[model samples]
Target: MFRKNFIMSLMENILILFIIASVFYTSQSLQTQKTIYVPQGSITNIISQLHKKGYEVSPIDRYILSFLGQPQSGWVDIGAEKLNRVDFLYKLATAKAKMEEITLIPGETALLFFEDIASTLDLDASRLQHYYDQHADYPEAGIYADTYYVPFGINEEQLIAFLLKESTGQFQKISQKIYGTYDKKQWLRILTIASIIQKEAANTEEMPLVSSVIYNRIKKGMPLQMDGTLNYGKYSHIKVTPERIRNDKSRFNTYRYKGLPPSPIGAVSFDAIIAAIKPAQTDYLYFMKNRQGTHDFTKSYRTHRRNIQKAR
Candidate 1:
């Protein structure tokens, strides 16, 4: 009976010691960023990574996290600059990353878009461009012109990959839905035309008319001679000049080369894409910007010249 009582007393003392140690461990202060990226991995691997990053996590965290739940992969919100061990571990398994919205307005070039993203996300602009160059199949218009919500701490490569992957899926879905198949080569041609329309049209309503003029001009073997075609890459907002037209010998300079530009000039909207695929049934061969800040389209060069004079 004495031996049994001694054994029970020892067990009770051990339990009390364990409880005290747990309390001390959980109460320790931890410093972390407000936002952090959590890679996809096992619980132990995540704990090790956190330790490597100077976060005070350990093997104990792996056990604590097992009951809390799986750690969320991607950017996560810690929600505080300093937290107790338990709270930090709990947040690792629970909190969602804060998101910021990025809108890619139609007709904006990828160069400008990457610049905007770098500025907004506080990332390296060159790295963003590098990742884009590495992943994108096309030189431009790989991402659709639309708004996107990304996590606050997303890195350059992940952001570029996400945008490209999302755009590719949507592109395929739209193509398959409309044409019953997705042909990348033919689709790129459509995108090139759509990009031209995106740059030229004053509004969504004008897209189909502009598309018709493009087709009519091409059918008649006339040069596109569009000012918008010159507004490519670094010259997205720069005014097309008479000197520019005379000097530019690239395929993008429609006055110098026949057919569509070898690639898209800028990003395009769904409306522009739709218009390119199905243009208005008209014999329009020319368009000039009128005083109303819209185009006056005509088949006759005489009428177009008169419109240009009226605008001046």
Candidate 2:
């Protein structure tokens, strides 16, 4: 009877141990679930703040994640971010590595550009603007004026560098296929002209033709009487009056300047750049925009004058 009693006691002890183990396991799982979404922070500088907020993470780990993620991590980005969710973090990290579409619409100023980027990716606009100011020469060339996909978490400098690299590659391929030549100085001049044309041209079909008109005028030593160049000078929007056209002395004023502008008016789209390089073969020397964005092109002064009269 005593032997049987001893065996029963041992069984009861084993059951109690099992219950304790199960309870411990359950507690651990619940803790994990509760803490999984702890916000480690979107900005690297805010990690300490996150810690203060009771997020259990090491600064070293956060730094490593940001460094590894680079352009996509701990930078000014667009998108909703949740703290400490492993799955969410994984998605963010992956997304950062991949390229995302960034649209730069026409008529947007530099400030608008920053806001757009920030709104889309949660990036710090002030940081980006700082970089832009310091490295004005960096984005000086080859930033195509179209929507482009850029890798996430990349700093502004790296993004601009990538753009320049891609632009150079594209320029090389196009030059080889069309003109069989690549001259940096000549291309810069062409890009400068193309940027102006891009802002002026309303119709894509007319881009190459308009480019031809500009080239013809340049070759003939006639002043490029473009309105866009003058508009670039005034901060406030003004009606294009004759006085404004004649008086504005900004270097961008092609009507006043004998040659191309000092720099591009804005980022030149690939199509515009290509059109500038390979303008349509035409004898057109003059063109003018109507109330509608479309331009009327003419080969002779008489035809141009007649079109102007009709426009009036």
Candidate 3:
């Protein structure tokens, strides 16, 4: 009877060793290293996935791995040739997703630009555009242009929040450097003036002078008469002819209307926004585009007319 008990104990020890070895082997070998998408669900979902992936895991082994971690929802690239049980569990528990980088260009309207951004992220462009139109209270004029990053699986609202937060941080830095004072009314006017400068100026050097023209007209109560201000809605710079100006009676018609436009035309560059805040100290009220792609600044309507004739 004692001998029978001894043999039974030895067999039980061997069985325990075999189970440990099998588990170790399972972890060291992943059928093939591939990307696995473990969505947010119960441990049962992960167990089913392991079976679907051609991993011959026993019920006990599945429980062991599942209980080790909660399922993280994302596309995780499992780069190892073979994953031991622990490694597989660790990778699934952590959502190590790839990031996508995108750039925002100055002067693009919010509708078009947001669509482009959504396309790059493989998201619904119309959804993103609608979100921007409905939620964002601020105009597009002062949005900072720069490259930004977004993680995989980020939702539309989350993406908008990230962009707004980053742009706010960028605007704050520039505000401190240039505006020096935080006044909402003043900033709105500055943004309006900056958008005009961004649209009208040929280069950085001309931005301040374009700003000067805007300020000078506003101060003297003279009609802005800027073609850029008329470049709005479905129509743009091409619609600023004498015929359109006479017939059109919109508030943006700077030739007929008085001061600045109701809102900015599009997003402005940092340089343009800064120039709007600090315009060139010039008495010139007129600017005509010269042959050299630069503008000829003049104080009198007579010189402005002569420049127009020369342009013709």
Candidate 4:
């Protein structure tokens, strides 16, 4: 009878353990059913927001996960994941530690860049622009130009610094690669010229050739005659008007100006910067955009005039 009682007790203990395991599994399953999105908010606020969004979470859990001696590895290990389950708070807290990303594409002006950062990263565009305008200084207008990747929650000043750092690094790399030396001052000048060429070139394929033409004209003491510069100085967009092109008194009016404009007109790409430093070795001094998105190049004034007439 004692042996029988011992067996029954062992069976009862196993049953209790099974019940406990079942409860734990159910709780975990419920947690997986919720979804949460934590914006730029404090841990407590984030938890409350998650709870309000129907997640099974508590402020204490978030506090512990975010700050209270929790291993950073555990907190951030969530990685990038979508919230498909109800127990989204834990997953979100884990995922929130993952770095968010922002991408800046080519040809993006300062205004557009700020807008994209603001919209994508939940930043204030005007405030960021103000910071850049006040703190960021380029050798010329729109000197820094390229694609940039910024992590989430970065401030205005930090973002500007990142861009400046990126520009510096890129300039150094390009200068060393192409010119065999890095000269900040001279490279800034070349970048200024490249920026203008970037705005003028009809397509990427024409950038090197257009750069060659500009170099040739400069070598011959001829006016650059870039309509894009005049358009930038007078118009809000790059679209050139006949009147603006005809009546060009602005400093950016390369048609009237004898040398490089006071500053760059727009953002330039790495290719443009490279082209500026190492222009194609050619005698071509003129280019006109055709409907095929390529330019008609000319080596002499007579041929250029004929091409212009044909373009018209």
Give the 10-residue window scoring lowest on summed lDDT in candidate 3. 230-239
> Which candidate number has the best TM-score?
1
Q: What is the C-alpha lDDT of each candidate?
A: 0.91, 0.63, 0.75, 0.66
Which candidate comes out best when scored by lDDT?
1
- How many collisions per candidate? 0, 15, 4, 9
Q: How far off is model 2, as Cα RMSD?
A: 6.9
The segments of candidate 2 whose C-alpha lies over 4 angstroms from its true place after superposition are: 1-53, 56-101, 106-141, 150-154, 179-182, 233-239
Q: Residue by residue across 177-207, what tens digits does model 3's lDDT show?
A: 7657566677777778888888789999999
By summed lDDT, the worst window of 10 consecutive residues in model 2 runs over 29-38
Model 3 misplacement above 4 A: 1-95, 177-181, 233-247
| For every candidate, C-alpha RMSD to the true structure in Å | 3.1, 6.9, 4.9, 5.5
Compose the digit string of candidate 4's lDDT tens values, residues 174-213. Answer: 7787778987667668867787777778777778888898
Single out the weakest 10-residue window by summed lDDT for candidate 4.
Answer: 68-77
Model 2 lDDT per residue over 1-312, tens place: 999999999999999998886455323311112122223346464455545655444465455456445224333332343433433333334443345688765433344566678778777777666666565542233455567787555676776566556667777787777778887777778777777677678867888988998889989998888776654422323456788777878777787887777766665666777788789999998887676868888899999898898778
What tens-digit string does per-residue lDDT give for candidate 1 at 181-267? 999898899899999999999999999999999999899888998989998988999999999999988889999998899999999
RMSD of 3: 4.9
The parts of candidate 1 lying over 4 Å away from their true place are 1-25, 97-101, 122-135, 150-158
